[model samples]
Target: MADSDGEFHADDASDDLEDHRVTTSSKHDTRSRSRPEKAKKGTRKSGKAAWEDIQRSWDAVVEDADGSLTAAIEGRAEAEKRARLLRDTTPLQRGIIRHLVLVVDMSFAMLEKDMLPSRYELTIAYASQFVREYFEQNPISQLAVVGMRDGVAIRISDMSGNPAEHLEKLQGWVKQEPQGNPSLQNALEMCRGALFHTPSHGTREVVIIYGALMSSDPGDIHETITSLVHDRIRVSIVGLAAQVAICDELCTKTNGGDTSSYTIAIDEDHFRSLLLEVTTPPVTRTQEQSNASLLMMGFPSRTLAAGDSIHYCSCHNRPTKEGYKCTRCKSRVCRLPAECPGCGLTLILSTHLARSYHHLFPLRNWVDVPWAEAKRSKACYSCLTAFPEVPRTESGKGKTPEKGKGKNNSGSVPTPLKGLSESGRYACEVCRNHFCIDCDLFAHEVLHNCPGCQSDTRGAQRQNGKATSNGDANGAMEIDS
Candidate 1:
């Protein structure tokens, strides 16, 4: 009986040992899996912190203009708190205002000796002085001139921050023989175009220095007046011996301001005051002048807030239908097998077409100050390099490069990046944006602000030697605005 009991105990001990081995093997497997998981968790935690830090650093710098300029990033929200403060606190003079000047009535009648020095000469002098004064007070407002004569309206120049340069172009335009028929319709149409093309921040106005000559296309004039009424553009007419019916009809129908028998002889102070009142907040216009009930509609005005998505479409009265729209000239085009149906431009269907194409290049996300100086210097957008090689015009005069001269030029075929089968693939560290190496190297060194950093790109190049100067304009570094 004792021998049988000892055998049973030995069997129990062996079963216990077997159970312990299974438990140890399970723990080993769990630990092996858990070790890798813990390591991965640590890595992710660090990465999250890094991303947060990057964002925080950017925000801090953006608050102040000195450090960096990432806040003007395309597709980013407006820094409203900052801008509001600027509007309120900045000690702007009462006369410090921007103006969009449009000269109307470029017809042959304007060449007649109706006003001092012939209406055309007086027009140029007074218009130029008004522009110079407005710019001297507020140099930041963009200026564009539209010459209306005959039956056609042509843009003398695009909206440019440097009105002086555009003024020079206007002078050149004046020297040319006047073409087209005398039509206020053309002038009004140009105003509509200017309103669409001009930046949303500035004030806009149309100054018609004419003898009120009626166009053969009177029907077109009525249609244009109706359109202007709806579009809410302030039309100021300076009549120099013009027909009473023409001036009265325009002033009454359009609800505009008409200076009858006036040839820049109105009280300067009163005129300035009138201009100031019109430019005041909730800017208004009226047929008959009064302190109350001034209707809105003025030039170079800030109707649209900053960062508002401006839809530039040739098709009037239609909301911007999405899909493919021409970036250049802002014309709407529907997709066909080939060709832009609206503008007849050859359509290259791709996401990068707008960015790569020079003419359709996106608007500047940030406001560049001292525009006259900037244009005079021909400051590069990347390096801010001014006075580079002078452009060879057909007339052999020095000129700056037109927008979009880099790789993937509007005229040239796009090439693939290194080992990549597409254009616009490289990245810049200083600019903190992607750009082709060719663009970076070309714009190295100058006062130009980076679209990414919004700071001088030269500093970025010096800090990081890894930054290649292949095509960057500022130290071969450019911020993609």
Candidate 2:
């Protein structure tokens, strides 16, 4: 291929390169051609499946990063929604007696490392908080925990009002490892069976902490949903991973086809928020329960077993040094806020009724006060907390018609807005008074009453002054105790 004078030729080198390229192409062709038809089809299908999984992961990570104030505004809106959910003061019949089933997904998917220390570990931690809050708010209610794993549902704990027992069972999971797939149908069926004995006057509900995207269901899930609906059972789902259509459909159908019954946790804090939201007792379905019914409950007296004496408990049949004695049946029980097994009578303290009382009459949500009006006030009306002053802008100094009163539009609905919070103050709709964030949250979430509206003294002071002038005596007024 080279010239006789030992000169290199470009044409000869080009021919060799083309031959090598053709050889490489043929090798690849033969390799692919050697595969059987079934193997080739499987490869194509698996490639698509893998691609779909990647797409889902991509979707999970891809969040809206629009470089605008939209995200902040939306975050405020979420806060507003929470306030509205917590602050409604309307009087309604609530479920005083309740039974809630917790359905947990224990599939191997929970072992994923996306969440710190693994999703399963964090889930148990969040569930511990949920159980604590559930019993704190629903002292008279019973709760059962059911776990779905290995294509079946297993009862982890029985229905009881004791938070300690549930917490102990959750602690028992440290030695166990998650395995297999979750069975949604089986979990629901087990919940339905366990809650079958729930009284008609009580609320029957299920809260699922689902982790896997797929459910290993053998039966028609719609049929199971139909049965749940017929039994007046409400279902709420807290999805730990990507959203699944079956879970959406299952929660919606069980809760009378309501869409709010299911929510996905974007992070750890959001997961805790969603889980605790279920702790508040759900409204009783009118057709299922009557609010006027008088249910009898026994106030058990706590007694201590003397030295060398063990009292037999009706609850666990175990001997304990101290137990509550049911006044009705004269039987010793292990715990209060429990039903007496001897006479089937509820044993609870009257103070426990206050746990659910605030729900019946929640405080109205406070609205944000805009900078103009908020600038007029130097301190909170309730707590007298100093409000940080906004640096007076040349524009703010200019006289402008105060149009932000529109922020105080209504007490019934919450509006996610920022113009109302230039000074970071919340205003009660009824009293039109500004309050700090801490006081606002405390009043709405805990106190459930507006201190200004409940204990205003200016009008009383004026009345006392007028009465003193007429009486021609000391300006002192006596308050009736």
Which segments of model 2 are wrong by more than 4 Å? 1-91, 301-312, 317-323, 370-384, 389-420, 430-434, 452-481
**What overall lDDT goes with each candidate model?**
0.44, 0.77
Q: What is the C-alpha RMSD of each candidate to the true structure, in Å?
A: 29.3, 13.3
Please, what are the lDDT tens digits per residue for candidate 1 over residues 1-481?
Answer: 1265554566767887888998899999999878864534424555454344544524423221344334234113222222211222122222112345455567776676645556666666656665554443333344567777766666777655454566687677656555456766666776777776542333455656554356645555667777766765556656655354655566555544544322332433333333332222223333222132321211111123236455433433344434345433344532211233355443332222211222122122222222122323333444443322222332454443343332222332222212321232223344444432233433221112345454344533443566544344444222221
TM-score top scorer:
2
Clashes of each: 38, 1
TM-score result, candidate 2: 0.69
lDDT of 2 by residue, 1-481 (tens): 6789989999989999999999999998998899855544424555554344544422322123343445355546545644544445567778867899998888999999777788888888888989988887778899999998899998999998988999999889855789999999999999999899888888999999998889899999889999998888899999988889988887878776589889999988788889998977777656648547777777766799888898789898997999888887788888888888989988887667655677777777777776667666788988898875543434555653343222222211122343335556778887788888778766766676788786654444345346323222244342221
TM-score of 1: 0.35
TM-score of each: 0.35, 0.69
